[model samples]
Target chain A: MGWTGRILAGAKFLAPLAVLLVLWPILIRAFNVNPQIFPDITAVARAGLESIRDGSLFAHMGASLARVAVGTVLAILVAVPLGVLMGVSPGVSAFLTPLLRFFSVLAGIAWIPIATLWFGYGFGAITFVIFNAVFFIVAYNTLLGVSTIPMQVRNAAASLGAGRWTMLAEVLLPGALPNIVTGVRTGLGFAWRGLIAAEIIATNIGLGYMIFVARDFYRTEVIVFGMIVIGALWLLIDRLLLAPVERATIERWGMVRSA
Target chain B: MKSLAIRNLSKTYFDAYAGAHVDAVRDVSLEVPEGEFVSIVGPSGCGKTTILNMVAGFIAPSSGEILVGDHAVAGPGPDRGVVFQSFALFPWKTVLENVAFGPKMRGVGKPERERIAREFLSLAGLSHAAERYPNELSGGMQQRVGVARALANEPDVLLMDEPFASVDAQTRMTLQEELTRIWQERRSTVLFITHDVPEAVFLANRVVVLSKGRVLEEVDIPLPRPRRWDALVESDDFKALANQVLQLVRSA
Candidate 1:
């Protein structure tokens, strides 16, 4: 991109955020809400300060991040290979697609009840929820990705002296990358929601638990503060990681038809 | 050694609902000698692509045989390279990587593969675009990478099925010239299929015209090489042959 384009893009991203910052004080004053029901900027700030001072914020954040990291990595490792294997044969793909879709539909927040029952309400249960959330969606997307690669391309690859393994590595995997990345983004989004929900219901620590615990004591400031942290964390991940990866794949692999 | 031989190669497709079998390519026989550039020009639906696909081992003949260097064709192998009409490049890979794919698949190590890929890239005049992915390059450049990839395998025969059909006329001319140059340098047996009469005349050592899924006639081009593009077009013989071939294609 040109310097002017880059600068304009940066400005566009920051403009709404700057406006939101400017409007914050007015919003707090106009609401006339109690500190216990809805925290003023100072109350939330003080809470944030207190949490940081006591190191509770770090501990919770670390636990949440660790769950996401472990769950997502495990899901990717299992889902991609299985999806590709199932996709190689049309009969297998046709047979398995409906089953996968059914499981993927049952992914995320819905898994909480069973996961808690199965793993007994702690890190294990939360991680299982996250893993199931990402796994089914990613596998479904990978299958779709591999299945949809143009047959002509596969024939072309084979005729150009590509063996079985080469066909899989060169044609199948790369062709499926855009869809796989898309699946990861969507799967991760569901997993994040499931994590939050699971933490609220089952875990003793983490951001969701923090909010739920605060709710019992009518600590609305803490709840509101936790919601902000969740939003900010998701924004950072999507913007900083997933969005760029998606953009790169689409731009690189998408066939642009000229008029 | 015979580069390629197809004996009574017949392929049938059954249309279940219609309760009739379609003979896509019926009893087609041809022998291509080593270092020959042969073009098969035919009408649409004359099973030109079906024949090419069978030779490439993408499909099997119902009752016939395909022999490459005395070995019966069972499946696609590295000995026969194919250039597809759509270019069919792996879009995610850079030009260098696409060209190197065949060598890499054959277990050639990185440094040697890169060096061989570089040679083919230069041969196709795409050395400058090595790092650029297929989507980023022009249609002409993408086809060039396809050619480079096919040649990198060092096959005994190169089968191109209307490789330039999707490109613009100007780009097609340049690619035709580049393909001719590559064929001359490597001397690989070529079985090229096209509907364009001029393209067949320009590139082939012998033009085998097909009509209604049969060989209508075979014309020895007798065009001398190293051929110059502008000069070949300006020649009276080239124009006459092109017209004769065009008439046959139109009639078919």
Candidate 2:
């Protein structure tokens, strides 16, 4: 709760990773594993440093992050309002629920082949995959969130003289925010994974591409380094960005047990 | 201040699947005079909440009309404020912001709204928690905020649907006393719904008892003003009034 307490808690999270790092080298020596199968810890570290020195690591990470950002932002901008619109009407929401569910299930990796065909295997195709991954889930979740607001709250707002616009702004939006933020977090997760898969299949740049290309040349060290970079990047994004946003929304809007 | 008049009001629900008609409230008529505190007490299925909701314009009567002042109630509007049993405070908003919501909806300026919110929050004894979100507060505190939010709208009539029913007994008592204090100062016409006989007797000038979707009795409370819960509950007059209503409900 305090600054020092938070710092200590953050350090506690690293304990498992620290143990894994320590075990990694010992396991490498004990097994006498072929380098082709798995690179040594030092080899992976050197590969990481080499990529960083050449600036390719930053370029790949930037490309991956940028695509996710652009695609997710665009998806959210379109999905949230549309979701709210559809959700406000029970008839519309009921009619569209099954359709949204179907599309959400078919999102992300399933769209990669069609997206590549449509956009000709480049940034456009990869961005499309990420967009597809984020869009349906966010929209469906937004619909769920908006529809779940208790009628009593809306009535309370209306009785207090909230007009259509006022109710939407003050009651509907704020009430549904906890759900919307959750949708964004989930959508981003799917989109992040989709972005990696799309990059591997279609794009010439990004963390996925870096690792996939390494596999062909027997560059297991580079592949391992890329995997670490991907994992670290995801952890940072989830912990620093999405998780905090989700936690704050839930804390602010959640039905907390009374103390 | 304007009185609330319910004229031959009725609500019937058609259960399509069951192929049956349910009369939630039947030919209910009552008058809550301006600045009067009226409580509707009833058994579980007596539709006390239906009457409250109708007055609040959340539900339309199948027949007859509800009038606040000279205006026939059309729909829910700022002229009437409702306090729900669940508190219904916006979880995302801070205490001050929740209180300010009504005034803000009515296009009050930001500074004026804040001042109005502060005044009501202080009246509710929640000024100390102005910045705290609804979820952070105790049930009583959140209900206090709910009271402030309703009052902040400056409605002609205050409609409360069992507002204190959800809280613990101790908190409910405190809230009842606090509500009486606030009502004494503001002199707003109030229609409070509750199942608890003692609560009805404690808060209302007149306690209306309902049974089977109909008015069973409306007993007047002659208890003196500035009533304290501890002292009032033990008094012979309070007990008599509560017992009378309790008997009506139990018999029905």
Q: Tens digit of lDDT per residue, candidate 1, span B144-233?
A: 999999999888888899999999999999899888887888888999999888999999988888887777888888888877679987
Cα lDDT, model 1, residue B22:
86
TM-score, one value per model: 0.93, 0.93
Candidate 1 residue-wise lDDT at A221: 73
- Given candidate 2, what's the lDDT at residue A191? 87
Candidate 1 docks at the CAPRI level of medium
Interface RMSD for model 2 amounts to 0.9
Candidate 1's C-alpha runs over 4 A off are: A1-11, A254-259, B16-19
lDDT (CA) per prediction: 0.87, 0.89
What TM-score does candidate 2 get on C-alpha atoms? 0.93
What is the Cα-based TM-score of model 1? 0.93
Deviation (Å) of B129 in candidate 2: 1.8
